[model samples]
Target: MNRWVKALRAPFFTASAVPVFLGTAVAYNHTGRISVPDLILTLIGVIALHAGTNLANDYFDHLSGNDDLNPHPTPFSGGSRVIQDGLISPKGVLIYSLSWFTLGCLIGLYLNWRRPGNVILYLGLIGVFSGFFYT
Candidate 1:
């Protein structure tokens, strides 16, 4: 579990989570109500996206020798050294990343079905595209 957390860069999930919380707060403030289910789903979707992005970054960085060339990798600076450190295989990382992306997209689709717009679909597409190519 510890290795998995390190591979997922779980500490950095706040970068994804804070915005979701703020969005929920804003919606509640405006409507005077909150749907707990939506909140939970949104959180899971965003975090999964975040985790997928992080893993994809690590995989691509390893592929391009970016992480390999880094001489001074810190917890915040360089990509997680899971591959380099042998905590997780590069193929495994890529698979996990894709799995997370799929899960996020599924949740996004569900949320879109609940709502009455294609906004979630558009956003999810943009996120997945950017994340996959962000290396």
Candidate 2:
């Protein structure tokens, strides 16, 4: 696989998107309506958030010496081995994570502007903070 692809951990994006899909479905089933643009924006924002979280985890784990000591790390236990394996630099990972996070925030701001509500802003802020501090 490509180093960039591995760094993004594309497979894990579904975990973030599933909630958005389920929520949209419930809303549609209840109201018999849906906003396609909103749905698309939500999905994009969520995927970016998830990617940022994963990158942050990889960067922090490497920084804290955890990944270095995990001799028999599994896919779920240890962080992605991209950094430890020299596939990408720690600085690169951090920058990538920050960029995704910024993108997610920008999407959230756009959603708030379109919908006129604080819910999106609050949720996005919480998700960003938690994801960045999870490790």
Candidate 3:
């Protein structure tokens, strides 16, 4: 349970929820009401995307030789435990990350394809860019 929690990077969870809340707020902001279903799906997608990013960051950093650096850095250098501390494996994290990311992307694409305007596309692109730079 603890390991799973760490893989999720609990601290970042709240930020993940923001999109759902924001999307709902947008729904309401213009019409004085929100779409509950949209809110729910947004939350789900957020969870998958954020969790996947966390795992990928862990896996890639490990691959980049930053994970093995002894004594740990000032949090400025790469390599965070999720794996280094034996909490998980690089392969396990990689697999989970890819799976979740794919799920999230599919969901996002589905939702946006139904006429999500530009918000969804912008956010999705931002996420992919973030994942690329995060390592």
CA lDDT scores, all candidates in order = 0.92, 0.90, 0.75
Worst 10 residues of 2 by lDDT: 72-81
Query: Sorted on TM-score, highest at the top, how do the candidates line up?
Result: 1, 2, 3
TM-score of 1: 0.96
Tens digits of per-residue lDDT for model 1, 1-135: 676788888989999999999998999999999999899999999999999999999999999999999999998767989899999999999999999999999999999999998999999899999998888
lDDT per residue for candidate 3 within 31-113, as digits (tens), equals 99766776777788778887788778788878876667646553434444778878788888888788888888887887788
* Runs off by more than 4 Å, candidate 1: none
TM-score for each predicted model, relative to the true structure: 0.96, 0.95, 0.79
TM-score of 2: 0.95
In candidate 1, which residue pairs clash? none
Question: Pick by TM-score: which candidate is best?
Answer: 1
lDDT head-to-head 1 vs 3, winner? 1
In candidate 1, position 43 carries an lDDT of: 99
